[model samples]
Target: MKKDLRFLVVDDFSTMRRIVKNLLHDLGYANVQEADDGKTALPLLQAEPFDVLITDWNMPGMPGLDLLKAVRSDPKLAKMPVLMLTAEAKRDQIVEAAKAGVNGYVIKPFTAQVLAEKLEKILAPAA
Candidate 1:
């Protein structure tokens, strides 16, 4: 289902970024890009088209919550599906992300199966 999808992975850690990229690749999404932080991700978002966004909540520059808000508020990218992959499991944080229009959420150290399930659900064909 993800063969034609484009994914943007945002994280402060290069290792984490590579992990997400590898997961996306293993899931059959070959077209994946990486950003070290929300600041970098924003420009990439503006210059390219990504079908889905998987971002970490905490970063040095712009937090993922703010990035989520920005993406949702932007007319051109507002409808893009976003999945928050973060270590922040706080109830309020989750609530905020949901309110910001995140399509899915996953706590850190999650299984690839769980990620795949969320992606499949979010990208399911409209009946």
Candidate 2:
């Protein structure tokens, strides 16, 4: 199931985008796209369907939280799952993301194992 899923990696930093993309690739999800910020991600997500969104909170154009809200509000995209991968680890921010419908939260400087675990939880139902 993971192999068939498509993903979008959104972050202002090219390095972070590459890191997430590579990690997704390593996990066998090769059909992934990159976006610089929430603004860019909004258009791409609307134009195409993505199984999951991995975004960074602090960005220049539109922030990740805004993106999550927009995605959830849009009828066409409301069902898409979002996972935040950012340095913003505050409880309030996490709670806000949860309210906005984020499926997972991963703090930055995280390990590959951590990312994998989150993905598994979102993509695979527990037995």
Candidate 3:
């Protein structure tokens, strides 16, 4: 993955967001923005250009799956890469996200290596 890729990390918990930010930084991806929930994230997505979206599956206003659906539905944002970084690990939920068009999915408690591999897998197609 390119280090310059702009990333939007959306999660309800500040700590989780921070952790993800730190991990991204460690991986040399510095151009990262954040939102606490999908509701907060949607406007940013519409307003700015992001190379990828990293979102949680559960949140107060609009969960990740719903946000993923919204992104897919929007004409401008339809092709944006989305990685579901969440704890929603049920097989059905994973299938749902895949059907909704998520580029990648990582369960919570993930390692940096795993995240890196997933990013590479998704970005490679476009690279």
* 1-127: candidate 2 lDDT, tens digit per residue: 6487889999999999999889988988899999999999999999997878999999998999999999999999997878899999789999988998999999989999999999888777521
Q: What's the TM for model 1?
A: 0.95
Going through the candidates in the order shown, the clash numbers are 0, 0, 0
Best by TM-score: 3
TM-score of each: 0.95, 0.95, 0.96
Off by over 4 Å in 1: none
1-127: candidate 3 lDDT, tens digit per residue: 5689899999999999999999999989999999999999999999998999999999998999999999999999999999999999799999999999999999999999999899888899766
Sort by TM-score, best first: 3, 1, 2
The superposed Cα distance between candidate 2 and the true structure at residue 103, in angstroms, equals 0.5
lDDT of 3 at 87: 92
**Candidate 2 local Cα displacement, residue 69, angstroms:** 0.2
Quote model 3's TM-score: 0.96
RMSD of 1: 1.4
Tens-digit lDDT string for candidate 1 (4-113): 78889999999998988898888888899999899999999989988889999999999999999999889999999899999998999898889889999999899999
